[model samples]
Target chain A: MNIKVAFLAILLMALITYIPRVLPLAIFRKEIKSKYIKSFLQYVPYAVLGSLTFPDILYSTGALTTAVCGTVVALILAYFEKGLVIVALGAIITVYAAGFIL
Target chain B: MKKNFLYGLKRGIPIALGYIPVSFTFGLMAVTGGMPVWMAIFISMSNLTSAGQFAGTYLILHGAGLLEITMTTFVINIRYMLMSLSLTQKLSQDMTLPRRMLIAFGVTDETFTVASMEHGSLSFFYLLGLITGPFIGWSVGTALGAFICSSLPEALSNAMGIALYGMFIAIIIPPAKKSMPVIFIIVISVLVVCILRYIPLFSSISSGFRVIISTIIGAGLGALLFPFEARDNNIQEMRE
Candidate 1:
């Protein structure tokens, strides 16, 4: 691998990633009280996960669907307030199974 | 502080595992695209954002302008702004600026999710878990991927290459079932993205441009159309 290119890539990635983390906090501070702005933050995780989910599941590795299956199993198991380790393992099993089967 | 590092790793590993392949792909692509492996690994090490690396590599490979690259990367990664602000609240009050800045480098979707789940007295071990796993995974994966892509047959790799998307879906779907609001936001975002992607005018644009427009527009629209008052009140009320 080209060390220079890789270093450049890492530097660039760090810079890009840092922006989203730094800029908003620096700029908005406490001013993020608007209902719309607040609401946007609230729903962000879900929106992100959602957009990240389906098409990839459908078209990607089919493991997403499998992982979804695993996650569902996890959610059901989650009601017991099972520790995250158990839940994660459960999903891992589901992933292997899903990848193998589907 | 040691505890925080360990905690970060524990939480970071699963995320790291997920990130490894993605980074590996980046590594392979970088070398295949004509960049070196050490440089790619260094890139993975420093610039932990996946999309940015992918975008940058592509731009460089194609000889795109620096301004375009910077603008493109900025747009793609703008979401971290929100994650960081939320993270500041979560960090221990004792956290120094330098500490915060360093730890901030590890802020990622999975890491942030795991961190956000913390109740109190932030676990450095958790952060360590979160960071180390993904960091190692991404780094090692990149190194190995570059090696394999260079050495192995193409057809098999392509066929098995679908696992990365699977990981993403795994991340997206589970929480969605529990939250309608998130699901709604996602659907809207996807639909908007799909629409924007296929538009005659937008179709000519590169992936970088498309991602910029679609994410900003989708996120902007979701913020506008969906009022999150109930959710915010709940989190703040719970914290109090």
Candidate 2:
């Protein structure tokens, strides 16, 4: 792609991401009402992140097996209340070592 | 207060560290996919989104048309709209329009999680502090990754790609372990995604819409299953 064309695509991408974020806060200045809506919003983070992590993460590191190993390591470390960096590093190291063996 | 801003900055340290390896991998992949180093950096600098950028770049590499790229990005990132809508409940009443707009731009998954968990109304300065660190880390990591891709070993780079997903798992696991409702939501969402992936009837649904669809279903089910009780906390208060 031409540099100009690529730049335009990036600009459009930036707009889509930015608009979603800005629009909601801009239009909905008042507090949200309704118990159902609030509860739905509360669970959005977990549900969204969960769906994104699985299946996708399995293919992220180039192999299903290594990704599973890394995920297992991450879960174990996180279960122990490890910090984010520590848990992530633990998974990375696990996947890296697994790369050598498998 | 200065202390709150500093606290927010301190909290952002882990987020920035988490972003580096992920953004670094994006940079490496972009260059490998035939993008110029500067173009990859530009995309990171402008977008600051993981899934959206990844999907958009993949289409670009395939020579997808502009309309295709735009639609793909919109579908992939529509979750942020939901996240930002939730975050509006946390912003202080007196926050001005421009500040809300600026803060909204920084409402990535990590920042949203951190900001939402805070007790009181979120401050503009604190929000700025929180986003600035990760912003720099993400952009700089991309630049570094693009520059060093030739020298970095493929095995090591591939392994490092797991760091982002590891971070995602790390973020969700503790909370899910603590709350049965959260665990239910996560398990249901995963099952929905799996079914959508393998079932022939759902195979025609694109990946971007699949995420949006599953998220709505999972969150809707969670709301129905575990309704919120009235509470005095700011997070709850803001929504009321």
Candidate 3:
């Protein structure tokens, strides 16, 4: 690997990455006085998570039916607010079982 | 009595468990991309960012530059800075600036999401509990991935991949089912990401750039159009 290239890539990425991260911290250091900003932070996590999920069904490699089933099972479990371990184990077992069948 | 390390271990255990597979996957990806095991461990320990480590490894393996890696990972993690600032307000409005600066690096997406919702002052000890879990988990996971990945079959890996996406779906669907705006935001973001990937010009941009751009566009548009908010004051508090 090109060490210089790698170094430069890391530096630039760090700079670009740092700005957005730091800007908010610096900006919001004061009480997030702006109602809009407070509101934005409030739902950004969910919106981010939501955006992440919708297409989780499509992101998989296996048969749609199996993958979809695994997802449905996880959703049902999460709906009950089960912790991460339970949800993950639930989905993993479902997918493995489905994989064997399909 | 002297403060004990076991206290840290106890609290970090849950996060450490989460880190196991997640970091393992990161390690697997790094090796798959041709990095050395030591380098993989170094990245995991130093960066402590699962996604950033993956992206950095991909860039390295693909023969990208340091500039590119740094710029890309920085952008992706910018959200954490916002998290830190927001958390600052929630923190014991008295934590010293120096402490905030030191702890800020540990301000992750999950930590921030967990910390922000809780009521009352934010303490370093609790954060230490939260931080140490993933720290050891990720470090060990990366090392495990380096050594253990080859022994693991591709099928198992693919199946485990389901967990990441499953985790996402788990968080989103519950709230989305209750609210229309969230559904709209989710649909819009996924659609935009798909379009960006499929459409000719947007596809030309770097993958890291693609993620950063998509998040901004999606979250910005989400904030503007949907403006979905909850009194998660109670729900968020429970996690902390």
Best model number under DockQ: 2
The lDDT per prediction is 0.56, 0.76, 0.60
Question: Model 3, A1-102: lDDT tens per residue?
Answer: 765565455445544544554455444556444544544545454544444445545555366867887888888997786644456557767887888897
Worst-scoring 10-residue span by lDDT in model 1 chain A:
A52-61
Predicted candidate 3 versus true structure: per-residue lDDT over B2-82, tens digit per residue: 133345446557767767876775676566445667777877776766445555666676675455566556544544554
Give the local distance difference test score of model 2: 0.76
Clashes of each: 48, 0, 24
lDDT of 2 by residue, A19-54 (tens): 888988888756556666666766766776687778
**Candidate 2 regions with alpha-carbon error over 4 angstroms:** A1-12, A61-63, B1-40, B48-100, B107-134, B145-150, B230-240
Write down the TM-score for model 1. 0.62
Which wins on DockQ, candidate 2 or candidate 3?
Answer: 2
The order by descending DockQ is 2, 3, 1
Cα misplacement distance, residue B240 of candidate 1 (Å): 30
In the range B103-202, model 2's lDDT, one tens digit per residue, is: 8777787788788888998888888889988888899989987888767676676787766566667667877777787889888888998899989999
Interface RMSD of each: 6.7, 4.9, 4.8
